[model samples]
Target: MTASDRIWQAQLRAHWAVLSARRDTAGVATSGLGILVGDEAEILAGVDARGDHHLLVPAGGGALVVEDSQAAYIRIQRCVLTIGGRGRTFVDIVCHRADLSELFDDVISSMLTELATDSREQPAVVCKRVLDEWRELLRRRGGLLGEDALRGLFGELVVLERILAASDTYDLSVWHGPDREPHDFRLLGGDLEVKTLGMAGSMVRVHGIEQLEPPDKGDLHLIVVRLVADHDGLALPDLVERIRPKTNDRRAFAAALARAGYSETDAEHYRDRRFMIAQVAALPIGDDFPRIAPSSLVDTLPDEVSALSYNLDLSLLLPKALTDAAITPLFTKGTLS
Candidate 1:
């Protein structure tokens, strides 16, 4: 077995040993805090006087409880019953006896590690963040996550990485998180909305009418990325890994990924599903561009229409497609008014 696997097994064995010794004891018994002889971090576990099992992490913070009716994993401040008055929290992942075998050591280790990583944060905040991440992962696992959205994000990352690699003046620091801003990317020059077209079609989806509306001061451009599903092409995770190194700030890039509803743990599931880029077209949104903007109409529509979304035929915009070379200059320098 690998070193990590061996260490995890040792920790699990130690935990079980402590529990077995206290199997008939009246009160809770702990494996103690701090790193054990053959493990990383503290290996803590115990059974309370009332027979409730507990797993303690001395460095844990936050109050988070994730459950589906019966089973629950709770994170709270450390105190009596397990490792009393330790000033550290014990986040316990409680499961039924029948499900005990399904509770792998690595899963518990991952939780403990995640909790320990954010030890400085308040318990509630950390709990919420972890719970959100867990829910996102579950969403992805259930196939509720959008595949088209992921592809679109990958395309945008491709363009962002290209811009970063080609020009030193193009500051990615101004780039906004996915779907957070009106446009996909907010560069120093202006904002660029990235649209990915999959399959054989000239149609591109405009999420909302506001997407086509340029910022008040600067220009806006639409980047149309044509992709084809392929068994051997690059996947979303591949694109993320490629762009991660190109980014100026790694932490910011990670936060951007989080905002995009992506987690590293969930990335592996999408690793093999790939797409090949067929073409990339950049079009400047000008007065001539066929789009509906709030400023275009003086009076509101009679129906009070909201969340307007439509598909635009790119074949109609073919005449206005800017040369690929022209795309670089639009983002290379500041054009903010």
Candidate 2:
């Protein structure tokens, strides 16, 4: 996927528009991108205009994750940066919500217009908001196997970064250098580098390959978020594990023993535990393995873009009446001689 095709682009456009319009008003600093606009009061007022409550989905692209229609809001939390030469400046927005009451009607109205338009091809997933930015992305969504992998990586990155920041204490401090490797933060001073282990309910054997990387020297860390899915694919409840892998690797085997209270030495000794449901462990450093750092989390993940939302799906927000016009034929006339 190109730079802007991600869902964040949609929120970026709306946010940038809001920020840009305020440029001309008096008392506003012309700091360009350096000017921060993430005043919680202003954001809260705007979101409150749409609805009373806003859900928190750290993984969402500044998007809202509320129960269906209860809180109609979409907010993209982000840290926008503007770098000049060597200096760096940033505007961090912790998006609470977007009051959709006013905009929803208009957004829905536009769908009415789109339905009248004449178009024959299927409605592509190119987010109109950022199509201009991601002109390089031409792959079809489901057709290309790689696309899903990339999307999942992007989604995972968004989730991970947000979780780190959402903690009671937040810090954007991360290590990077001239090498420009994707996730090579080989700084393991007192931190731990981790990999996700077993699943929660299903029978698939769980042994993390990434964790095999040499442990960070001292403090570096890595976090693994594993979701244990049941037969139907829903994440099983709870984050504890009952079983573990049978391996010479003691660390891997320990979990199984702990969960099932089984001795590590027995043959087939891994079967005693129930396994983890859905757990996310953050690693603070990297190992000797080429590029296994928190920054490199994206590189390790598969590309896939799936939205975890509660109130409303973005697709529905777009409206089917409009999509029908773009993807399906409005008229069909047949006459045979």
Candidate 3:
């Protein structure tokens, strides 16, 4: 576990201790331990009349917790937990089994860490995602991403940073690559497909026919980011942390990062994986561009060929590259589609 994780665990235990002490002394029917987890979100650790331990996470924006969202380790529901005569709605998570309290602490620690990460998502959304991720982790352990995946994610973050810099209204949901969308970013004016290559590499891999296909009504542009590993350059974690503050919705951005298979827990793994940009080329996909799209292959190809993957040599497409000034306009012109 990281130092941050340890601190969160200690804080949770301290809060629980105070609540437990109160439960024993006054014999109160219920007690709450409310404390700030992040800049805006507050957490409440409580002891019920039956001595059941509960953790209440503020459910921002009136987000609801569904009925009986329980697992073997914890029970979850929505309720208004009060302390010091102040009431606030929260997603209440209960650990009835004493033997599972340690496990519960770990879970709460993870949730607090996520909440504290400058997330802009609703508190309920962040809590549920953390719980879901934990459930997946326990079901089958997963390892850190490979070098190629890391580079791809790094390139996407670079572009996202550019987009954020170019516009004031940041909507992280438009970044659909992590969700396995056909395009990496869906902007109002067009859709963008980002490809990351080695500094010396020439070929750009086209994953599917839909990849280069234009949006239903807008244009499509392919962004090629060529990078080289350098000791002086920034690592994945550096870029992530740098961009986190610029985004208005940090939680949503964090969730997008998580979906892309990047996590703070695995930051140590990418410490040495620093990258320097070699070049960034923006090429608008049009009729003249070389690509295999469903529209281009209409009625001519065999039905048996359901999928396609190929490489395009970037050296052959120099004339198509857009200038740096032109690149920013593509992201800035469109509202999030």
Candidate 4:
């Protein structure tokens, strides 16, 4: 086991011990491990008054599917936990056997470490994957993604639809954002980084300076997708279904969706999150583009000053937005150069 595994295991054991001491406690005794969904949501582990070990994974609102564990030692179900005075939904994984508490601790420890590593993924999604890795329970689908992630995905799909309509050779492979690439799309001509904003907001949060940095030999364009929430608009699942048929390769597209923390099983949960694309402006990133790149930061900030992120106000560049005719060459020829 790694050092992180040991730390998590120790914390779980300590929390359990404390719960055991106060068996008459009314509510759950939880120890925060790592983030699960949004900024306020987190993954927790504790022991009930009955002394059962449980792992609480936060989930978005949906019908909880409980697996039949008659032959297994653990029970999995959905529940509402009163955490910090809020009724939050969580996937409760309870170990019924007292003798196997130590083994369960080790498994929980490893799972916590995995969640810490893939901090971007939803905790329930991570939990499902880890459960499969251990092969201790039935394989189940994860819950819906957070609202921010869902909207961001919607924006990316909108851009993807445009790309597919404009290009003949570019397939789903050009979308490298799902694979955690530096940029969202890498076309043969150059690179295109996508950003999404909701409502009338003109500011787009840029993560890391490398996101705006242009390619060495080709041009780099920034595309900002502005969205508005409306009941008349199509939801994320609707857009996914609409775009799924356009792809020549369904298998690769499904894999891409999985990498993006989206599961078809959880589609029903996102039916209410409808959005309409307000505007999509493509701007060629140049030296004067409002950004902080490696070139601009070199010799000024130390190497230790990394993971830099900033907000780029699009209102300034909205006037410079390229027309459809001007942006067509990038798709047809692959690059502006």
Candidate 5:
């Protein structure tokens, strides 16, 4: 088969594997969340080809290898990845671990926020102010408000943008949407979710800010995020759920089964698939306000990453900086299911 065929097959298989996992995990922990798992979770021991014990190492050029167990193994492309793991806990080694990276990123960000010429005019402060204000106001206008008109008014691909926009504290500082490649978004360089909830007069809550993922990009997946409310008195998750996918695509799996040549009757045995995001950010908008990187999201990144890659993803939460001063309006609301 050709590479494209291989990708298609892999995609099908990946969907199958994910659906299988989702049947049980309740979405908190899964293969894609970067948690390197094995077929034998309860009982398995031994290392890979290397003398070091089996464990999750930073497989890619820039992931956190959460060396959880010597018996755990990481993979690449599709198969299990072979790598060297020194003595220590597996979680500590990987770059994807959030606690370490996020704390570090936050400290650095706080320092930078303080060092800026002045707080109000500083890019970071401006970003926080804008994001906080917008999210806050929306939280106030409680009770099933219309999302379409609200989002367009606040400016976002999802109605959530307007829900957040009502915040006096948070404004849509940056609204990033997903692009063709680089399938996901993260806080700073971390891949998870970053978003706000709340309304004016109360306070805004930001989440997925310090969440962790396995750093794994294929097959099994895990999605994690944090949620904060601006003030009090509103079911945020309920409102947000109105938009997220009900579940992973199960038909995608049946198709895979059929492709593998299974009988239609057997194919129907597969459970429906599911997907979820802790939070979503907006795409890059022009930089009227300074677009500071949420580097504070990570603590100990791999030895390799540079400062430049953090605010790079054209996310729906974060805006892209434009060179031209003129602002041209464009359609930026709703989601692609």
Candidate 6:
């Protein structure tokens, strides 16, 4: 743990002592930092009362418990963060005793900073945002990829390499964020979504119907990266480290990594795996590309069929594939600018 963590832990201990001393009373105990810790979870009101920004974490739950998904941790009755008050004057962001990981410390520190600096947003809202961010970060670290970690990491690397090669302004921030983003990388002129396959597979999974659908005015291209497991190939950490120096803002790059679910704690696992890019194919989302857009299927499908997903065989898309020479220019600087 860092010095900051030690200080925060000390403060928490002091706060808990005060709370225990005043257990019989129903009032707020103001800390040296001016943070009010109420006796209960429902009545916290030192900050904004909008309720959207408020977060209540439980206190004294042994040790910090980090989990794979936000739902799993947040939804449980154990030390969890929740919005809205049940009539108590305080909501505690519980610090678990099992694992006081750096991530939790950072989260607590961030919430306190936000509370101290920004009075416009409700505390609940601030807490919610912080929890959500951490949850997403944890998801990226291990949840989303699950068993397909190598393939997913390779896909992201392919996109990152292309972006770095194409633009001097390339940053990891552009490559990772909310997975719901329509494309993998958002550039000046258009967006690029990258798909990767382990073997010489002809099919690629289209996550959602909107994945292949381009923005109304800009360009959207799909890049298929075929990879083969190579013992001597580059590890995920090596690729990340190599690109880290190229980023304009290191803080943003780190935030982007957290947002994408990549954590330093799990870096060792990825370093053990290696892969080499074998083939690259690029296809522009045009009239000729094989895809199903909601606009096109809205009238044909049943009204009840709101969400749909399917796979497309690349063998069928061979005729539309951009030649290697043609695809190279797409990654060149100013191609999107």
Candidate 4 residue-wise lDDT, 114-227, digit = tens: 877747666666666665554422122355578777877888888788788898888888888777777888888889888888877888888887899898878898887788
Q: After superposing candidate 3, which stretches have Cα over 4 Å from the reference? A: 1-142, 334-337
Give lDDT tens digits, candidate 6, residues 123-149: 555566766765555445445344465
TM-scores for every predicted model: 0.58, 0.23, 0.61, 0.57, 0.18, 0.55
| Candidate 2 lDDT, 49-109, residue by residue in tens | 3222221111112332222221113222222222333322221212222322222222222
The segments of candidate 1 whose C-alpha lies over 4 angstroms from its true place after superposition are 1-144, 170-172, 177-179, 334-337
CA-lDDT, candidates in order: 0.60, 0.26, 0.74, 0.74, 0.25, 0.56
| lDDT (C-alpha) at residue 308 in model 5 | 33
For model 3, state the Cα shift of residue 249 in Å.
2.7
Q: If ranked by lDDT, best first, what sequence of candidates would result?
A: 3, 4, 1, 6, 2, 5
* Prediction 6 TM-score vs. true: 0.55
RMSD of 1: 10.7
Q: List where candidate 6 sits over 4 angstroms from the true fold.
A: 1-144, 176-178, 298-303, 323-325, 332-337
lDDT of 5 by residue, 243-336 (tens): 2222122222222222323222221222121122224333232223223323333455456754333222223322332211111111121211
Q: What would the per-residue lDDT of candidate 1 be over residues 1-337, giving only the tens digit for each residue?
A: 1344335545766776577667655655666534321223364666555444555544343344332222233333345343344454444443324222212343444444445553556433453455454444333223423877687777787778767876787555666744367787776667788888877777888876778888887888888888898999988877877776566654356556766767554565687789898777788888878877766667765577777788888887855686566666765752323
> Which of the two candidates, 4 or 5, achieves a greater TM-score against the reference?
4
Instruction: Tell me which of candidates 4 and 6 scores higher on lDDT.
Output: 4
Worst 10 residues of 6 by lDDT: 45-54
| Candidate 5 segments whose C-alpha is farther than 4 A from its true place | 1-194, 197-237, 244-284, 292-337
TM-score of 3: 0.61
